[model samples]
Target chain A: MNINEIRNAARRNAGHVRRTPLLTSPFLDEIAGRQVYVKPECLQHTGSFKYRGAHNAISQLTTEQREFGVIAFSSGNHAQGIALAARQNQTPATIVMPSDAPQLKIDNTRALGAEVVLYDRESGDRDAIGAALAEERQLTLIKPFDNEAVIAGQGTIGLELANQAREEGIRNAQVLVPCGGGGLTAGVALALEHDAPDLTVHPVEPTGFDDVARSLHSDRIEANAQRTGSICDAIITPSPGQLTFPIMRRLCGAGIVVPDEDCLRAMAQAFTRLKLVIEPGGAIALAAALFHRHQIKGDAVIVVVSGGNVDAPVFTDALNRFA
Target chain B: MNINEIRNAARRNAGHVRRTPLLTSPFLDEIAGRQVYVKPECLQHTGSFKYRGAHNAISQLTTEQREFGVIAFSSGNHAQGIALAARQNQTPATIVMPSDAPQLKIDNTRALGAEVVLYDRESGDRDAIGAALAEERQLTLIKPFDNEAVIAGQGTIGLELANQAREEGIRNAQVLVPCGGGGLTAGVALALEHDAPDLTVHPVEPTGFDDVARSLHSDRIEANAQRTGSICDAIITPSPGQLTFPIMRRLCGAGIVVPDEDCLRAMAQAFTRLKLVIEPGGAIALAAALFHRHQIKGDAVIVVVSGGNVDAPVFTDALNRFA
Candidate 1:
């Protein structure tokens, strides 16, 4: 909600979350027709920025709360982030994931020492299951982004980015984020509002999953009509969260939606030029920065590549098609 | 030549170069059976560590020498590094590249504002050509590894690595470096000797092109029988440099040579686990750290991924086969 909360979250998340690099390349600059910087959160623990929020949320709990542990409903970056964050705090975690979710995500979450509760995607209500488990174990639910603590944690990235950008003499620019629930976007906007007001924040999403963007434009909460068909799956949430929507609507610029093709192309460019492995969902912000250059109004742009937990086949396909 | 030289190089390189992150992954640690930290120089400018040496060498040159210009004989990383460094310093650079070298490297060098003079790799004496060009233009030849300033530039990585290792509480570790003319290895070894003496340094090379290893073992420089056949071409110099070899001999531990298969596997691992794009040549140190775990000592191992400039086909093949 404020800079102080985000600053406190930074203190709690220190030594746990990685300070991902702000990567730059001349090739990317030429493509964008402007200076481009990438904050690669894919290099974060569990291969996403989700870890920052997860760790920060868990760190705020009381001693008894940590002992009883935490629970979450997800099967991707959020699942892994909670699993690692909980384990690191010596807290137990129960992740209620779809039975049909990718085996690798399930396995990786379990490997991170989480109690993985598999729910049938078609027949089971995951929220009910997670709620029941949390009640039984007295576990706190660490929402992916809606929770204040989580947003503050993700804002740590914004703090680091602001400081790093200033270090690079980037006094003013458009900061692009791959938005799903608008947690990162809101947190980044808040940090910039306090630290570097000259730099504006924009939420970029996949074409079909532009809920946050639509919500900002209409000055109201909006939901996506469809989410399953897009290749950019990581940031595919139903809509912006209750806590995150207000911040995003107040401080953010119009959202930039990029096609899956552009995300794939951005992935390939990141692979070959910057030597970074960015997943399609994670690469969407970069895609907008590169392909939607006409829409951006600045001499410089900074993009937060959200995550890199893509499957081998999908990654190979991206390279094969665009590299 | 010493820690002071490396310290000075870091000072000169402050704003001009990128201080690449020391990346770590749980998956990598699981594979190596130790706390593995990767110094991803692949993320450096020009997609390699050669930029450090190039910038350092250029910075130390007299104004007259810089105005007169500089030259180098390389078709890959060095050419690009020199080209970018020269451009940043407003110094004219002429890169004498082999005609058979990759077209991408040549074009990239030229794009960075370097004069590209291609010589026949099979017939034309590249040495003679480079010498002639340097003589006619009154250019200072920045040797790839043999020069003192260049080696000191590479040593800056060692200083950073030592500091990062301590930050992670890794006091004792084996630092594996992908060895070519031993510039990086020697630089890192010298830095570790002064800063983190408990961290032993090792030169990791491809099996057949183990010239530095052989030279170290025999107490004399030993040339590789063949260099053109190795996929690890970025680190396939004939032998260790005269300046670098002595430092490596005194400060480095026994060499660890891994197979080409291991290098490819390491590249895939880096891609999938660490979200890093590493070339086979650059992945050699990681390969040695992962596959040759038994040969290493201590509970921690640090590897410097030297570069990431592999062609797409080669990268795709690596992902297809090992990812």
Candidate 2:
């Protein structure tokens, strides 16, 4: 909820969440004409920054709540994150997923010691099932982005980015964050705005699902018709959450929309030049900086690569399309 | 070189050599019934452990040698390592690469501010071209391995491994090292043998080019005149270098050979389970452990994932094959 709370949460979850290396790319620097640094969340536990929030939130739960178990509704990174967090906390977690979720994600979630409950999105809503399960079992429902603890946990990444920038001697630079439901962006903006106010914060989203950008433009929480075929499957949220959107609207400077092709190109560039494997959603900020270089300031830029839990076949296919 | 000298060299090059994470793998543990930890060299600069040795060797060059520049002959990670090291040292570098070397590798070397001289391996030897270039340009030839400076530099990985093992409370464990010209294995073995004498060290090689194994068995360097195609491009060296072979023979507790299929499987497992993009050569040690799980010591084990700079098409094909 607050910057200090986020910092404390991050400190508590330090050992659990990987302090993933913030790598500099000589090739990316040449392309952007700026000092480009990548915070690889792909290298994090469960292959995303979602692990940070999930772990931090789960770690701070009441013993009674943890004993009753936790419920999460996600078709991707959040499912795996909650699964892994529950496993680490020695608590049971039930993850509700759409039947059409990527098998890789399902398998990873199950592998991390979470019970998977699947529902068809066309026929039923997974959130309803998750809520029902929580009510029936008196389980604690962990909202992916709307909850205070979740936002605070995600904010830890911003704390890390600010520290990394300071350590790297980057006095003033823009931090690009990818927004799905604005959880990551809200957390990053909250930390940067409080501590490193001089550091500009940019939240990146896909063109089709640029609710954050729309909200910034209209000064209202704008919602679009639920749609899902973006290359960046992880950040395909139809709209920002009530809790996260307000924080993002206040703390974020501006939002940028990157094309699907830009996401593919950035994924390719990450694989080849940065020697990193980033999922499309994880690479949206990188894509923006690469293709939308004109929008960025020619100073030190830190891009938070949100996650890397991409299915191998899907990742290779993306690379092929870009190639 | 003595262990103390190599340790000092590693300490000197610590700032340049990334302290790659010793990643834990519960999946690997479940499969092998032994706690499996991976020392991720794939995440290192230049995408391999060669960077440590190359940078160590180049940085220690005398003022006269630095002015004259450096020359290296390799078609893989070593070329990129030397090129980047020389460039960072602000010294000119002429890399003599095979004409058929991966274009990506060539491009990366050139990008690092190295002048590449392509030579036809069929018509002439790469080492001969490198020798000529060094003589013509008055540059020092930085051998990929088989040199005291290079071995000392490569030993840094071993030092890091020791620290990682200590941090993880792994007092005694079996450590697997991928062997090519035996430079890496020799360095790692020397460091481990000296620092952690309780640790067991195993050298793994391709079934086709088990030069270190053969040399260790014969108690002398053995050249395999029969050149066979190895799926692992990085470890296709037909024979072990004289300098490295002796050290490997003295230090390695055992040697093992893994098939191409095992390497491919290991690479797939690494990509999917570990969320890492390790090249075939980098996955051989993992392959040896996974395929030879029955033979390895029934204790905690560490696998040195050597490098991750596979050609795009080849890597795609490998992923497809395993998929």
Candidate 3:
């Protein structure tokens, strides 16, 4: 994807999306030992930046394709994003999700006007279920991060933040983004490369699921040994997407890996300092910015808190432990 | 304070203050049964709207007075606001706080570069101590809500949100503001009277501390019987300010009083739906918008969540019971 595509997507997504605020606090700056700017996509529609991709992708569809509707397979932020975006576009949406996914997610997707089809995740193949459903309903399958339109949509954040950085008088900095399938990281890296050449992008991942980091290190695609049961479930893909890895490999700096505990602490810090409720997966990039300060350069750092679709118990636990 | 004063405060606050975003969600709209717009002053500097007034008041001080420094007596949001604003203007601030105040507030004020003077709440007279200290140092005393410049500063929110509401296509609506000493409510009421005439302003208070409501009803100033023991400490003032009450009496609609439980529930709801951390006092306006819809008159309602500096245990309790 190019700047033109991101610009086009931004134009299409204009009124329907929120240009979420860039947040900062002196308390956070002291903790990170530098100026820390936070791009809280959790404040975005559907409480995640995934809505940017979902909305853009839906907008990119042909009238006939949109009339036929769209299908996606997700049990978390992506599901809600697609559901809400499709509803806003007046396009029917069907989300194939794991039966074991949190009831809150399932209920929220349904509430957003999407038909949720749940399959057994342990034994059932989500791809097959989504494919069969798509074929039966003549629906276009929307990949969360693998598609070009979605990546371009996510790149809009890059374009917005580059200007915001300049407004804040930040000349050079590293931007840490949570790495799931590398869609957000690659998109941000590419946009920053074109707009703010002095600013570098880094993908931050959890220790056990650092596939994007390993892939960049080895100069090839890498897969995680284990996927399920990660605290950061929103970012536990098997590996980096085929479309996203190459852009990230070229444009991104070395990846930053943080532990789950640090992610929890970051959640508490977001609550205490920013008054934001961030889920564990969404807090990892912030964790990297605050905890992995030794690996970073520049006097300022920007972290993209990717999402905030977390349960109360999980959030309270974080606050209790750290706040 | 008049429109001219608010306009001047807005100009003074242009660069240093954040014009915090107006947030809304379908979920909140569904709960309120109307389009609900939230002005999260909880996201403001010092995690409250108090910063606006503090900065404006400090800036209003004469160069000689500013050089001599400023002083205030507050143990909560106001203390931190004054501390930060004073530091930003390179003016020394001395805050006389009750020794029994939460350690977090005291520490936060001190961390922001203010000198903390602790006094006993039970026996020691805070006014006497503050007056003595001010007399000794020749420091200008900044009242929390009674000062003309401070009220004008708070009025800036009304000016900002008036334009924001019109942009959202809201021609007529009610603005529910958390009422402490009525500074925010009176300021916003005055500003909206000029800028957004169709939008009425209402003061929201907790049940026991409905002094503003009683005073508005009686057409005379009234004081609360209870002095302490409130879940919403931020808004536990005995009565409205002499200056602010007159303006509130003229411009404000009937005051809306919510029970402490509803405030707690609103806090949990803000956390769950808005991904925002709101203190009990700040959540009262939102609670009125959701639970007291019958008392309101409009197809849309705007609520200002004024602060978010709750302790962890209290927040966790709200989550545990309601979330």
Candidate 4:
């Protein structure tokens, strides 16, 4: 997608989405050895940046398409985002979720007035089930990240960051974004490329799920060997998206991978120092900024905290174990 | 302090202090039975609104006074605030803290380049020690909340809220502020009284320490029988400040008292829903908004989360126990 498409998406979701804050902490800055500004998308609706993409994609549907309703499949955050967005638009939504998804996410999706269909992650193909259901119901399928509209919606965060940096008189900045299927990273890179060319964007991923990092290095798509066991479940996609990898390969400077331990430490630090509840996946970029500070080149660094839909027990474990 | 002084303080603190975001959650709104907007001063420098007052007080010092340095006595947040503010102005700060203060607060204050003198809270008089140090060192004494400049600085939050609400097209709102010495409540009330007269401000206090509530009703200063206790140690002042009481009496509509359990619940809610790590004292106003919503009036309500400096163990307890 182009910068104009992203700008149009931003305008479309102006009042619908929250203008989340770009927060800073002296402690985090000291740890990172740079001025660190955190764009906490954990504070976004549905406790994730997925809301922006979901709202943007769903809001652009034709009258007839909207009347036919929408269906999507996700483990957590994306499901809640699409469910909430559909509910807001007075459209019926059917979300196909993994049976092992966090109970809170499932409950929240249902609470948002969506019909939830649960399938086994190991035994069932989520895509096949979702497609069959959508076909039967004549419902439009909303992809989590690969779609053009969704990418444009996620790019609004890049536009916001550029504007926020300008307001603070920061000309050049290094931005680290959490990469799953690479949609968010690619979208932000495209926006920054167009709006703030001086700013460099990098993708940060959990160690085992470093497909985007591998893809960027090899200049092609790459897949993870295993993904079912990572603590950062939210961004544990098996590989980078087809549509997203190209933009990221073309625009992003490099990729950074942080271990799970560092992600837990980052989550704890975010809670104690920044007073922000960041999930493990969301804290990957921050972890890279803090632990891999020597590798990043910038006076001002922006870390994107992507989501906070973690379970309570898991969060408690991270906080206590890391501490 | 009048609105003009507060306006000047806001101007002075424009770049020095963070313009913290006023966050909102639909779930919180559902709980509060109104549109609830949260002014999370926990995200402020030093993890509390105390930074605003301390910076305002210390920044206004003359060259001679600044060279002489400053002294203050606080159990927690204010100590860190003054320490950081003094260090920023190139002034040495001597903080007389109770020996029983949170270890994190003590470490943070010392890390910010301040001298810490710890005394027993139950036996030694903090005020006497602080006064003696200030006198002996020829240093100005920065009262935690009672000074005019400090009150003006805290009033900046009120100014910010009014401006933010206006930007959101909200004309009338109900503001709930946690009252310790009544400085924050009074300062915010004064600003709202001048800028948004239709907005009513109320003081929210822990159940046993509802001295401000009683004082307002009786038209006189009142004291909490028990001190050196309560999980909300950040705002466990024995009574309302002499300078702050009159303003609160004049402008604040009423007061709300919430139990400690409610505060813990609010803290957990803030963590889960708002992705905000709020201390028990900081969550008191939010508790009032959520649990005591029937007592408050207006279509829109503003809850000021005053601080987030709880010990890790304490926070974990709140999260696990409340959840």
Q: Which is the leading candidate under DockQ?
A: 3
Report candidate 1's interface RMSD in Å: 1.0
**How far in Å is the alpha carbon of B245 misplaced in model 1?**
1.2
Q: Please give the ranking of all candidate structures by lDDT, highest first, separated by commas.
A: 3, 1, 4, 2
Please provide, for model 1 over A1-323, each residue's C-alpha lDDT reduced to its tens digit, 9 standing for 90 to 100: 79999999999998888998898999999999999999999999989999999998987789999989999877578899999988888999989887766565788899999989897755787778888888888989988889998899899989999899889899779999999898888888998899989999999989888898889889999998864667776777889999999999889999999999999899999988888888888999999999999989889999999998887778778888988
**Per-residue alpha-carbon lDDT of candidate 4 for residues B34-53, written as tens digits (9 for 90 to 100):** 89999999989889999998
Put down candidate 3 lDDT per residue, A1-323, tens digits, no spaces: 77898888899999888898889999999989999999999888888899999999998788999899999988678899999999988899999887766666688899999999988866888998888888999999999899998899899999999999988888779999998998898888888988899899999999899999999999999999974767887887889999999999889999898999999999998988899989889999999888889988889999999988888989988988999
Per-candidate chain B TM: 0.97, 0.95, 0.97, 0.98
RMSD each, Å: 1.7, 2.0, 1.4, 1.3
True contacts kept of each: 0.84, 0.36, 0.76, 0.62
RMSD of 2: 2.0
lDDT of 2 by residue, B107-202 (tens): 888888889888775676777777777787898988888888898888888888888788778967888988888888888888988887777788
Candidate 2: docking tier: medium
DockQ of 4: 0.71
Candidate 4 C-alpha lDDT tens digits along A196-314 = 99889999988888999899999888999984777787788889898998899889988898888999899888887888888888999999999899879979898999998777777
DockQ, Cα level, model 2: 0.53
- Single out the weakest 10-residue window by summed lDDT for candidate 2 chain B: B224-233
DockQ value for model 3 = 0.84
Query: What would the per-residue lDDT of candidate 3 be over residues B1-323, giving only the tens digit for each residue?
Result: 57999999989888878888889889989988999999999889889999999999897778899899999988578899999999999899999987877666788899999999998866788999999999999999998888888899899999989999878888789999999999899889989999999999999999989999999999999999976667887887889999999999999999999999998899988887788999889899999999999999879999999998888998999999998
Residue A137 in model 3: lDDT: 92
User: In model 1, which residue pairs have backbone atoms overlapping below 3 Å?
Assistant: none
Please state the CAPRI-style docking class of candidate 1: high
Q: Which of 2 and 4 is ahead in TM-score?
A: 4
Candidate 2 residue A65 C-alpha distance from true site, Å: 2.1
